[model samples]
Target: MIEPSYYLSNIVQELKPSGIRKFFDLAAGMEGVISLGVGEPDFVTPWNVREACILSLEQGYTSYTANAGLIELRKEISHYLKNLTNIEYNPHNQVLVTVGGSQALDISLRAIVNPGDEVIVIEPSFVSYASLVTLAGGIPVPVQTTGDMEFKLQPEELEKAITEKTKAIILCSPNNPTGTCLNKKELEMIAEIIEKYDLLVISDEIYAELTYDEAYTSFVSIKGMEERTILVSGFSKGFAMTGWRLGYIAANPEFLNAMLKIHQYSMMCAPTMAQYAAIEAMKNGKEDVIHMKKSYRQRRNLFVGALNDIGLTCHVPGGAFYAFPSIQKTNLTSEEFAEQLLMEEKVAVVPGNVFGKSGEGFVRCSYASSLEQLQEAVRRMQRFVESRT
Candidate 1:
C-alpha cells in the first residue's frame, strides 16, 4: 500500500487544528463542566424561522438554489443591511449567499490571494482569519492590539503593516476573542489607509447585531469604501441559526463574481431550506434579535463585572458577547489558565493565544451562554483565581 502520507497535501498536513477543539473536548468529557468555550450564540433558533423552513418544505421548495443563492434571500439581506446600517447593495449582482460566514471568508481569501501575497490581520482576532489566509497562499501579518487600547486596531498600525505584497486587511469588528468594536471614527481613519495603500478590506461583521456600546458601523458605509470592501455577514450569530450553516457576502459585483466562481466549484449554494428560513429571519426577526441581544448585554455586564471583581482586570468589551480578561496577574499563560480552570473547577473557556500570540496573557469567556451558567462559570473561575494566588 502507498504510504498514508504519500498523497496528502503538504500545506494541509502541517496546518494545526483549531485550538478551541481540544479544550472543548476536554470539557465535554467532564460531567459537571460549565463550558464558555465554543463561540456561538446559546439561544435557540426562533420558532417563526423554523416554521418558515417547514412551510417551504411542505410547499416542495427544496432544490438547489442558484449558485449565488436564492435571489429572495439575497434581497432580504440587502434590505436588512441597508435599513439598519446605512449601507446598500444591489441584491441581484452585489450579494452572494454562502455556506456560512466561514465559507465566505475562505472563498474570498482564495479568490483574491495569489501565492505569497500578504493579508494584514488584526491580532486578538478570530482564529480562522490567519489559517484561512494561509490556506489561500497568502501571508498573514498579524498586528497586535492591547488591553490599553480596549483591543481596537490602531490606524497607525494598519498603515505600518501595509506593503507592496499586502493585498487586503481582514477587520472583524465586534471582534471575536476580544469582543471589542471599532467605532465610526476609527473606521474612517482605517478606510483612509486602505485607500492610500489601495488595499482591499475584508470586513467580517458576523456579530454586528450584538454590539453594546456603539451603534455598529459597516465599513462599506464609509465614503468611497463601497468599492473596496468585501462585507461578510450571516444569520447564525444574530438569529441563533448556527446549525443552519447560512452566510452571505455583499461586495462590489466584481469581487462577488470572483467569489461566486470559487463557490460554484466547491459549494454550489447555501442550503435552500436554510435560505428560506433566513428570509423569514431577515424579514420579521428583528424583535427576536433585540430580545436576544438585550439578554446578552445583561450577561456581558454580569460576567465582565464578576471577572473584574475577581481581579482578572478585564477590558469592558463594547460589543459582541465575550469578556476577554487578562490572566497576567496570576502569571499564567492563557492555555495554562484555561486548562487548569477546566481541570480544577470544571469551568471551560478559550485561551487568548488561540486567537493569536497577542492573546497570550488573557482568556476569552463567552457570555453567549445562559446567565445562570455564566454565574456558575464566574464562581468557578473566582475559585481558580484564588487558588492560584
Candidate 2:
C-alpha cells in the first residue's frame, strides 16, 4: 500500500489549517446562532449587476475569455482606477483578472516569492496572508499593530521587521478584523520605509471603497513606489459581488507579465459572466456602493457603541464593517470569550487570536448583518458581559 504521508507535499504538511475556520465549524451546527463571523458584505449584488450576468448568458457569451480577461472589462477597470485613484494601467498588458482578490494574492505570491524569502505582513490583518506566503515558499514576518494606535502599522515596527531576506510587504488598509485604515500621512511614512529598503509592496485595496472619513490612498500612487507596487482589488467587498469570484491585479508591465504566467497556467481568466456583471458594477454601481457604505457606517456606530457601553473598549473604526473590541475587562482570553459568547449568548464572533497574536484579548464582530440582527446581537452580548461580571 502507498504511504499517504509520503505522497503529501512537505510544504502542505508544514501549513497549519486556517484558524478562522475553527469557530466557523463550531458555530455551524449550533441552533439559533447569530453569526457576525464572516467578513462578507450583507448586501445582495445590485439588481442591474445581476441582470447584466443574465443578459450575458442570453447573448450566448459563455465561451472562455482571454487569459488576461475581457478587453472591455480591463478597459473599464483601468478607467475606474484612473478616475478614482489616479492610477493608470494599460488594459491589454498590465491587468490579469483572477478568481477574486484571494487568487490575485496567491498568484502575486507565486510570482515573486522564493523559498525562505521573508514577506512582511501587518497584523491583525486578513487571515490569508501567512498561509499564502507559505504556499509561495516564503516566510511571513508579521508586524504586530496595537489598539493604542487603532491597530495601524507603525513605520518603526516595519523597520524592525525588515532584513536582507525580506522580499515584499503586504499592505492592507481598511484592514480586516480591525477595520483600521491608513491615512495619507501614515502611508507616506510607509513609503519612506519602503524606499529606504527598496522593497516590493503588494497593496491589498480590496476594501478601498469602504473608507469612512479619508480618501483611500493607493500605494502605487505614492511617488517612486508605482513601479514596484502591485495593486490587488476586486468586486467582492465593495460591489457585493463575492460569489462572482472576480478580481484583478495591476502592476508594471513586467510584473503583470510574470503574474499572468501563473494566472494563465493555473486558473486562466475569471468567470465570463462575472466579468460581464463587473463591467456593469464599474459603470453604474456608484450609487449602490454609496448606499452600502452608509448602511455599514450606521451599523458600525450601533455595534461599536454597544460594545463600549458593555465595558469592552472598541476603537472607532475608520473603514470596513468590523469592530475589534478588547475583551480584556472580562478577563477571558479572546478564544474563551468567543466560545462562551457562542454557547451562552447564542451570538457568534471571531476570536481576535485567529488573526494573529496581536489580536489576543479582542474579538472581531462584523456589523454586516441587518440592523435588527445587529441590535439583537449587541443585546445578547450585553447580557453575556453582565453575566460574566
Candidate 3:
C-alpha cells in the first residue's frame, strides 16, 4: 500500500495541528474541567440578530447571495466601518462578505501572497495567521514581541523583519492570546515603518468592539493607510455570533476583486441566513456589544488579578477577553505547565508556546467564562501553582 503522505500535499502533511485544540479536546474528556482555552464569547447572539435570520427564513428568502454577498449587507458593513473608523468604502466594490473572519484572513492572504513572498507575522499572535500565510504559499516570518513590550509590535522589530521579498504584514490589534491593543500613537509609529517599507497590511480587527479603558483605533484611519490596509472583521467575537460564520473584508477595490475571484470559486457566498442576521447585528448590535464588553472587562479584572495574586504575573489586557500570564516562575515549559495544570487541577489553558517562540514562558487564559467559573478556575490554578512551588 502507498503511504498516505504520498497522496497528500507536502504542506498539509507537515502542518502541525492547532495547539489550542489539543487542550480543548483533553479538557473535553475530563470531568469538572474549567476550560479557559478557547477564545469565544460567553454571551449568546443578540435576540434581534437571531430574529432577523428567523424572519428571513419565514419570508422564504433562503438562497445563495451574490458572490460578493447581499448588497444590502455590504452596504451595512460599509456604513458600520464608516461610523467606526471614519473611513468610507464603496459598498459595491470595496466590501466582500466572507464565511468568517478566518475565511477573510485566508482569502486575503491567498489574494496577495505569491510563492516565495515573505509575510511578517507579529508574535505571539493568533495561531492561524502564520498557518494561513504558509498555506497561501508565502513565507511566514515571525517577529517576536515579549510581555516586557506588552506584546505590541515595535517599529524597529518590524523594520528588521522586512526585506525586498516582504509582501505584507498581518496586524491583529486587541490581539488574540495576548490581548494587546495598539493605541493611535503606537499605530502611527508602526504606520511610519509600513510607509517606509511600502508594505501592505492585513489588519484583523475582529475584536474592535471589545476594547476596555481606551477607544479602539482602526489602522486604516491612519493617514495614508486607507489604500494600503485590508480590514478583516466579523460578528463572531463582538456580536457573539460564532456559529453564524459571517465576516467581511473592507479593502481597496483591486484587493477586493482579487479576493472575490478566489471566494467565488471556493466559498461561493456566505450563508444567506447568517448574512441576514449580520445585517441586524450591524444595525442594532451596539447595545449587545457594549454589554458584552463591560462583562468581559469585569472578568478581565477578576481573572488577571487572581492570576497575579497567585504569583503568575499578568499584564492588564486593554482589549479582547484573554489574559496571557507568565508561567515561568513555575519552572516548566509552557506545554508542561498547561498539561500538568489540566491533569492536576482540571483547569485548561493554551500554552503560550503554541502561539510562538517568545510565548514559551507564558500561557493564555481566556476570561470569557462566567464570573463564578472564572473564580473557581483561579482557585484551582492557585492550587496548581502552590504545589509546584
Highest TM-score model number: 3
Residues 231-255, candidate 1, lDDT per residue (tens digit)? 9989889899999999989988899
**lDDT (CA) per prediction:** 0.91, 0.92, 0.94
What lDDT does candidate 2 reach at residue 150? 91
lDDT of 3 at 126: 95
Each candidate structure's count of clashing pairs: 0, 0, 0
What stretches of model 2 exceed 4 Å from their correct place?
none
TM-score of every model? 0.98, 0.98, 0.99
Residues 29-93, model 3: lDDT tens digits: 99999999978998888889999999999999998899999999999999999999999999999
Decoy 2 TM-score against native: 0.98
> Scored by Cα lDDT, where does model 1 land?
0.91
The C-alpha local distance difference test score for the whole of candidate 2 amounts to 0.92
Residue 138 Cα positional deviation in candidate 1, in Å, after optimal superposition: 0.9
In model 3, pairs of residues that clash are none
Which wins on lDDT, candidate 1 or candidate 2? 2
